[model samples]
Target: EPEVTQTPSHQVTQMGQEVILRCVPISNHLYFYWYRQILGQKVEFLVSFYNNEISEKSEIFDDQFSVERPDGSNFTLKIRSTKLEDSAMYFCASSAGGVHEQFFGPGTRLTVL
Candidate 1:
């Protein structure tokens, strides 16, 4: 089975800066999602995308966050401006469709100063 993959396993950025977390979800999956775990908190959904458009997004996913599939295999989350509260482990996940299990990436740890 193919697994989701992410780059820059660790990222340290200054507050108010921009960061783009990259991911390559399982090739065959049609639904993609972005989730984050704030250190000790539970994993929280950020956004979900399908058919090259955003399907849903949480309140936490404000104007500062955006998702895009620039090419066939890459899905990315761009944080226009980072804040101290934004530090977390960002994960990428993909599912074949409804009711299917979502395979998750190892995650990119973002640390904002």
Candidate 2:
């Protein structure tokens, strides 16, 4: 089965640097999303994008964050200004449609000092 793939399974960064995490979703899926889980917290929805623009974004997705499909197979999440609070497991997900089940990537661990 095709799986969503995320690069740099783990990363360590300083509190004020920029970080860009990459993902490649399943070929036939649509409706991509990004979610984060702080160390011991529940998964929090960050943003959802479709048709090249943001469809929905949660309160957690602020000015520091951005998402883009830079190419046909790559989707990326960039935190322009990282913070200690930004450390978490970021998962990339996609679904065939809004009503279908979402498949998640293994997740990229971002750690800010």
Highest lDDT model number: 1
Any residue pairs clashing in model 2, and if so which? none
Residues 70-90, model 2: lDDT tens digits: 988888999998999999999
Give candidate 1's whole-model lDDT: 0.96
- Per-candidate clashes come to 0, 0
lDDT, each prediction: 0.96, 0.93
Report the C-alpha lDDT of model 1 over 1-113, residue by residue, as the tens digit.
68999999999999999999999999988999999999889999999999999999999999999999999999999999999999999999999978458889999999999
Candidate 1 C-alpha RMSD relative to the actual structure: 0.8
The Cα error of candidate 2 at residue 91, in Å, is 0.4
For model 2 the local lDDT of residue 39 reads 92
TM-score of each: 0.97, 0.97
